[model samples]
Each structure stands twice: as structure tokens, then as C-alpha cells.
Target: MEESTNIDQCTMEQKEPRKVTKRKFRYIGDFQVSDLECPKKRRLYWNPTQKFMSSSRRKYVTLKTKIHRLKNRINYLSTLLTELTECDRKFPVPRSIDFNKQFVTVELIQGQFVPDLMNLIIRFADSSK
Candidate 1:
């Protein structure tokens, strides 16, 4: 009976072969590197373990962030400009405020102000006319 069981097991093993399943790697986009001479090196290069952002995707994200930041800055500046205009109206300047010609005079005022900010303000004021 043991001999018969052993023979049965041998036959069963011969009848069915174990199926070896290869790992299916998913690559980003249609581009794939399969020209490598070594299979092991190819597998390592195509390994999904390492996450990488494509250059176009990185640029898109950077542009999106910049646009959002600029939009917020524009909104803030708009509100600030309106408030400043209202305040200026309420408290009239003793002297005529001329943005076009008074840049030199404004720069002479004793206060901590960025030159770039002053330039931008002057440009904005000039463009509004």
C-alpha cells in the first residue's frame, strides 16, 4: 500500500507541472526600456519600487503653484490698494500726489520701504491712468 501511494504521488507530480508566474511591471507612459542586454539589469531599471516624477509633470506642478501664489498676491494687493485709496481720500494730502513725477520725492520720505515695491506701486499707478 505504501509503494502504491508513492507511485501515485510520483505520477501526480509528473502529470502536473508547477506554473511560474513572472512579475508584470507597469511603466509610466508608452516608453519602456527593454533593449538592455542583461535581464536582471533591465528588471532593476524598471523596478516600480523607485518613484520618480517626470520633468513635464514637475514643471506643471511648479507652474500651478506659481499661478496660485500670484493670484493670491494680486487679490491681496487689490484689497490693500482699495483701502489705501479710501484712506487717502479721507485724509487728503496737503500737497498734490503725482505718481508720474513724484517718485523722487516719495523716495526721499523717511520710511522703511522696498525699492522694488515702490517701483511696482509706481508702475501700477501709472498703468491705471
Candidate 2:
């Protein structure tokens, strides 16, 4: 009887699903900004860049690239926040907006924000108008 019980316990253990660990995503170093440029319209524009260690590739990469305008800073941030929330619902996307400098920063994940995803979001946003 004891041998039968042990065999059942072993079978139950083997039937249990194994837990898979996910690789952590983290940012490396400090955020850097490109030189601000003033166009003929006298509007200030700049690009904010940050290096992040890709969770899958395990290498440093430039993940953020967006030109920010000083005039429409608030609108830009709001639009990005709304679009991101509507498009990606799986992982929590964290974003920081610098009103003084007129730039936005976002924590990115590999395979999360591909060009196609961004294009789709942009098109969706535009179509709603």
C-alpha cells in the first residue's frame, strides 16, 4: 500500500506544470538628449535618446527615438499615453514627460514596440479623426 501511494505521489509531481522564469528588462546608464534645433517656424525640436539593455538580445540598444516639439508638448504626451494604453494592454508601459525641456521618455521592452505596432497605432489614432 505504501509503495502504491509513493508511486501516485511521484506521478502527481511529474504531472505538475513547471514554472518558467522571464528575463527582466532594465535600463542602463543615464538618458541623453540631442541638441535642440530651431526651425524657420521658430519652434524648438529635439530628440531624447536612452540606452536600454534588451531583455532578449541582452545588449544595449537605442530604443527611444521621437522628436518632441516645444509648442505641442502637452498634446504629444497625451496622445502617446492614450495610444500606448489602447494598443498594448499586456505589460505596464511607464512614461515620463519633461515639460520644461519638452520631451517624453518611455521604458521599452524588446519585441513590444515594433515599427508595425507603432504604425498601426498611429493609423488607428488618425482614422478616429
Q: Candidates' lDDT values, in order?
A: 0.70, 0.51
lDDT of 1 at 31: 33
Q: Give the per-residue lDDT digits (tens) of candidate 2, residues 10-123.
A: 999899787999533232222223212325212221111122223433332222222234447879878887787778565467656576433221323445446766898999
Model 1 segments beyond 4 Å from truth?
1-53, 88-129
Number of clashes recorded per candidate:
0, 0
- The residue-by-residue lDDT of candidate 1 on 1-129, one tens digit each, is 999999999998898877999645555543355535677756555654344446567889999999999999999988876676689467442466788557755665745346766899999999999
Enumerate residue pairs that collide in model 1.
none
Predicted structure 1, TM vs. truth: 0.31
Cα lDDT for residue 87, candidate 1: 90
Off by over 4 Å in 2: 1-71, 88-91, 95-129
